[model samples]
Target: MILFRRRTLLLSFFVAMLVFSMYLMMSGNYPKVIYRDSGVPDAEKVSTEDSIDSTDIESVISTNGSGRDFFVEYRLERDRLRSQEADYLREIINNPNASQESKDKAQKDLIALAEKVEKEMNVENLIKAKGFEDAVIILSGDSANVIVRSEGLSTKEVAQITDIVTRTTGLSMDKITIVERSN
Candidate 1:
């Protein structure tokens, strides 16, 4: 029947889009190089003056009162809220008293949420793999906002990020906004 064929076609289209987006994210055009400074010295023996206090190190590593901490906390909070939403949706789907229409809507919403999460993660990872220290992307209704860990972004960096977001979310370059958060 036409309806069955149409559904099949749509499913195929979505699958292809997913595959293409993943390919773009994993492409060798951008090399993956992670730069990390452990902040530890090579010398095992340390002078008393040279050794930093444990409390000082805790302050440095603590997620409180720091600019870089914002990203980690934000991600944790976002994930928590998303988990709550997903649980509610699952509840609605499982409730025997729920209307079929409501259950169907909840299922669609859950699927959409999953897709959005995937796209956001893909964009974030691609941006970081491109050499950013950290990045966060929120894909909301026709627009994406990207925050990167840097003092500022060069034109080329902006273009690369825009390309990743647009390709992953299928949004226009104009719909993507890139901002920097200095450490």
Candidate 2:
């Protein structure tokens, strides 16, 4: 009878301990704002899984790369700057003081640059839809640099990326470089 009582007491204590532990785990320093919507439609929100930060990105690059990180944000900022520059150039061309030759040149450059940037953004989104945790594509003069978060990559994965980028940009494989991001 004594042994039975002791066993029951120990079991009760363990159950209490488990509940306490779970309570502690459930409580954290972060606020839970994921489900609350403040009037904007879901489609308009960038939804880079705004909850994730950089360190989280480095440690756990999930299969989905839509999560916002340094690279994604940087790409966004770069795109905004490019758009602004084009707008500024348009203003310059519209200025009464500008020469006709200058306006013509600006118009041509803007058309070419706009097309390239738009293509790059489209390719980036296509790659992201493939389930990469985070992807960054930088298009320089002749080649493109792509960085993706993943523990590792197989030849097939690289080939998949090449296929996507090629289809979007019409760029040959030689000019496309696939790079895996490291901590």
Candidate 3:
């Protein structure tokens, strides 16, 4: 009976993973995790010392407005996931054993990823080079969002961001959003 129980658990785990991988392949945003909120308090933060300096962490949790660090971390994570999706597509495209249909789809996905990555990187670079402390640019189908880390923004600051985005993207006024996060 113990042996049978072990076999059943392994089979269930395999089936669950197969379903997950299939779902990931079909989605354009391949791996933005879908989590149902369970009302359980996180134990990690609860037990941690409160005096740790945030700048030391470097990646996330920067000192300043919590919202600023939030956007920085979100953009970093989103780009990473998109990169992984691109890798998966590239593998399929390069696989000699892949079906022609699968190869064609992978090729298309690769092009899409390339264009998106280029735009995102260019926008972020231009924004940061233009004096923003840090910037994350998210371009959707028709519009773009520029999330910047700063100590809030003034009218001149907003105009500067808008002008830079318009010049860089050739996007009209309504198509660009400039968000300032204090940090």
- Every model's TM-score: 0.65, 0.58, 0.56
Candidates 1 and 2 compared: the better one by TM-score is 1
The sequence of per-residue lDDT tens digits that candidate 3 reaches over residues 1-183 is: 853564365446445645754674576422333334452425542223222122223333333223333644455455445656666776886788999999878766666656665666677767777787777776666677777888888888888888877777778979987777654
**What TM-score does candidate 2 get on C-alpha atoms?**
0.58
**What stretches of model 1 exceed 4 Å from their correct place?**
1-68
Clashes of 1: 0
lDDT of 1 by residue, 49-104 (tens): 31122232233234334233556544544555566776787789779999999987
Evaluated at residue 108, the lDDT of candidate 2 is 62
Q: Note each model's CA RMSD in angstroms.
A: 12.7, 23.8, 16.5
Best by lDDT: 1
Candidate 3 — which residues are off by over 4 angstroms?
A: 1-68
Q: Compared with the true structure, what per-residue lDDT tens digits does model 2 show for residues 20-105?
A: 53674477421233323353434433333412223332333352244434553455445445656666666866778999888767
CA lDDT, candidate 2, residue 176: 91
Q: Give all candidates' CA lDDT scores.
A: 0.67, 0.61, 0.61
- Tell me the spans in candidate 2 whose CA falls farther than 4 Å from its real position: 1-68
lDDT of 1 at 53: 23
Rank order (by TM-score, best first): 1, 2, 3
